[model samples]
Target: MTLSKAFYLLSPRNFALKSKIPLRSFARGYANSEVLRKTPLYDFHVENGAKMVPFAGYSMPLTYGNVGQVASHHHVRTKAGLFDVSHMVQSNFRGKTATEFLEWLTPSSLSSLKPYSSTLSVLLNEDGGIIDDTIITKHAVDAFYVVTNAGCRDGDLAWIKQKLHEWNSGQGKEGPVEHEVLEDWGLVALQGPEAASYLQSLTSFDLRQLTFGTSAFVPIEGGFNVHIARGGYTGEDGFEISIKPLQTVEVTELLTKVPVQLTGLGARDSLRLEAGMCLYGNDLDETTTPVEAGLSWVIGKERKELGGFIGAETVLKQLKEGPKRRRVGLVVEGAPARQGAKIVEPTTKEELGVITSGIPSPTTGKNIAMGYIKNGHHKKGTQVAVEVRKQLRPATLTPLPFVKANYYRG
Candidate 1:
């Protein structure tokens, strides 16, 4: 659904993919119950004993009946877990200049991307600030599939549509880019160590060949065809299956039949946090640039030199001169530092930045956080203090991805 439709249908609890923003913010923005919306799997969630919560305008599952958040988190790490991510905005861009259009939007090198390959990218504004973080998958020269955060639905769509119009109307444009929003599509993320083995039994498309960052259209039992991508937000080996709205429920039921645990947003948050992934509204905002977020690797080396994309001047400048502040991973000594927690120097308590995301890592048994800190203080082993609960907690800057990622590259 378009963000406006979703927001108006949404309720006070606020169901969304990116909710690192304080709950008070949501209360102020969308407190009315009439605006709450639901995904196609709303009935399925209710039937499965999901604890309904308002998020990003949808009534989403926070956790199933008796299953605790920690259990679900561990289950996904050791076995398999099913996550309903249908609230995310999915779209397709097609046209002769589609590649160029995408290149112009982000700093990534889409021209060199192989078919069926995907890469994490960011949409930037004219000032080189990030509009939203996105996953762009190249299906063909003219066909591209993109998945953006649910919370960014409104802004992302508007920016993309406006850019498409401008690109099409430009005098020297080779061809216009066509934008298609796939509203209410079903996106199921099957994650964990056993994901491949479970999926292999239902599909004959050689799951082994579908390595990380790749995707293919495969036929499953009951003659159902779906688009499956080999990557997930969690640090586990997994697949994200994209199905038509009509077949989503059936496909989800079939996939969750045996070993897959029904996971909810509670676990999803901790999982992505441990995986070192950034949530749009929290770790990323329009004022933040990819370089400052430690996402310089997403920029292509050639693209860096050519400087073609929007906000290239600022991004390139940051790459060359270095960002003033850098996002860093930290291990807190006591009490979990949450969003908005101030990051300060140890002795002087000089504020460097603030924590964008933080949680007690289910895997590491330690309080972990990701935040922006002054460049020199971002190195590992550096000492810092996080203001948690009005007290300064000892923190040490550390490497990101608290848990090692396990993507099936082979």
Candidate 2:
């Protein structure tokens, strides 16, 4: 029987991963009855009684034990919640022209980035559509740390490897750079208003210096040095810690012991939705431009004029004039508008757009959604209509980030 999201609060204790799929084949779907993918913390998740479910090819915890999605959602907002995000792909690249290489892949200006600082960027296709969205962290002129969603693994890796090969066989250009995938690593996100205070007791490194969008290697209580990044998918102040495989289970146990709760995908979905973050398949793909997704900020000013990267000409032109359709926030009235929901002009019933990512936000108790609207109606507070089931319902062109962000600046 399909259970309502509310019914499984604090679920059953018997949890196990019947199968474990590898990280390389992330695009393939998973089924409980068939093959299932596993993260580095798979064994630990089973031991902790996490309810394993098939998600984006991995057998991940959707909810833990008997704790429901709502309770976990509340815990992360008010206190602290720990998430097993090890399925995400983490890689480090180093060499001269690193910034140039990355700039060719994404529209962001990596050269201007401060050391240890990160920026959200997108890999665009030759047609100006996004191949994948990613986070690029600058350590120095020649070093970078990048993180991409697990769902986009195959496409992203293939693209990068192909580019690397092409760059290596260049016309007497500098040798191609090298990259290492931290494939065996595990990641945990400690998020909430109380996150820093909770994590502060375990590390000697000054958490004060690590602001949002920044990262540093920190020495922890058990003497293990971890890469602590001060940012998260949730809108709250939080950190994403990257740990070695052998230390993962121990670290997860230590962090979730007292005050910290183990949250699952349900809470994560709602939180990211509230934060105005896009899920790859739903909001972005090879057909969508960064400009329409309210991500023009990522396009570097210098890159716009030069236009040498893939889709650079198309993306730059769109930046100068504007995209035909624009992604924007929405407040749906009546039922929650889901992906593929048709958006229409309220009075004339003229088709305008479609919903992309949406959820009934557990934080604010509102039905918030995001979608792409036709060029002219992208402004905030513009009225529109969405077809739910069969009838049209009113929707407001709301400002993004249904909730406000509480990033740690100091």
Candidate 3:
């Protein structure tokens, strides 16, 4: 499913009106109403007049009050916005072999990652297809914290457990690894330009020391100590705070006092797209490899040469020769082209590829999209046509991240 389609499927009844997009059937569908789960701050969302919707099997807030998606998107880009991402799965892996086990499952160089530093990594199947994208934080050589997508919860957990069992049963070098799921934990993102200042007011910790991709446990105003990671999906200088279940509501309330609006799925989608981040089910799938998805940087240089991880052969081969298709960003003129839209040669109308995600970016005020096209035609400035609403709209290939990322490197 395309990211837009997935959002539409899980969105509330009034979502079409709010987003100003016509509702249409998608080829891939998600089973809704099977059993919807609630996050720790469900009641908090309701009390604040949030429009709740079913997303990734969780009842999540789509927007707050009467704030339109474009307004929320702009708020996140200019000021600050708070997001309830508690539905995401958080887990801890520990044991003597934890590093080795994770390295085997992914292509990231976990051993070299400094303590409290995080790297975006992907879980690969045997054929190098992406299972799920994850953020792994190294607290110690034997201990690591992982965060994964909520939509892939059951499958991801099952796969990890099965692999853990298999690795534990064998006798190679390091000891058995233990996996612990942090169920009911709260993960909130304080994102945007003013995110750091708002968070600094509530804590004494030196925000300057916590650069992007690094995390630290710090005490907040209410004496609550939480893990604060200095990076977010928005490609802005922000922080993702992980809190205990019992303190979730209080911490969120404290953070949303002023300047930080309660943003939801609607804005989150646009922000991520502008940032050039991939949405799992939409931009990535079991049949897509990381290299093809434009995630080659996640693979460690040593790991690429040594070829220890699963699907390394295919990834290494692609690294050497190049992938048949490459993920690229696009600037479509006239109209916004959404997921499943066809990319074709401008004149001959020959098929090239399909759009996985697209939106009229509030930050850029232009139609932007991300998808894969034939390798040679994926270069910047290459003109192509996108089939939107049965009309071929002119488009040009551009670099990923239509907006300049403002990550605080310091």
Which one is best on lDDT?
3
Q: Each model's C-alpha lDDT?
A: 0.87, 0.82, 0.89
Q: What is the lDDT of candidate 3?
A: 0.89
| Candidate 2 residue lDDT tens string, 1-410 | 45754334322212111111111122234443656568888988888778766566677787777787778888988898999999889999888877778877788888899999999999888899998899899999899999988777878899988887676567216646887899879999999999899899898888999999999999988878889999999999999999997898888777886688988777887788888988887888889999888898888888788876778878888888999999999988888777789999988888999988666777888778899999998989899998987878788998878899899997
Better of 2 and 3 by lDDT: 3
lDDT of 2 at 331: 87
Ranking by TM-score: 3, 1, 2
Instruction: Report the lDDT tens digits of candidate 1 across residue range 231-298.
Output: 99998999999999799899999999778999988789889989999877778888999999999989
TM-score for every candidate vs. truth? 0.93, 0.91, 0.95
lDDT of 3 by residue, 1-410 (tens): 89988776546645744674322211122365377789999999999988877677777887788898889999989999999999899999999999999999899999899999999999999899999999999999999999999888999999998888888988425699999999999999999999999999999999999999999999999989999999998988899999997999999999997899999888888899999999888889998999899999999989989989889999999999999998999999999988889999999999999998888888888999998898889989999999999999999999988999999988
RMSD per model, one decimal = 4.6, 4.9, 3.9
**How many angstroms is residue 304 displaced in model 1 relative to the true structure, after the best TM-score fit?**
0.7
Best by TM-score: 3
lDDT score at residue 401, model 2, on the 0-100 scale: 89
Error of 3 at 11 (Å): 5.6
What local lDDT score does residue 331 receive in model 1, on the 0 to 100 scale? 94
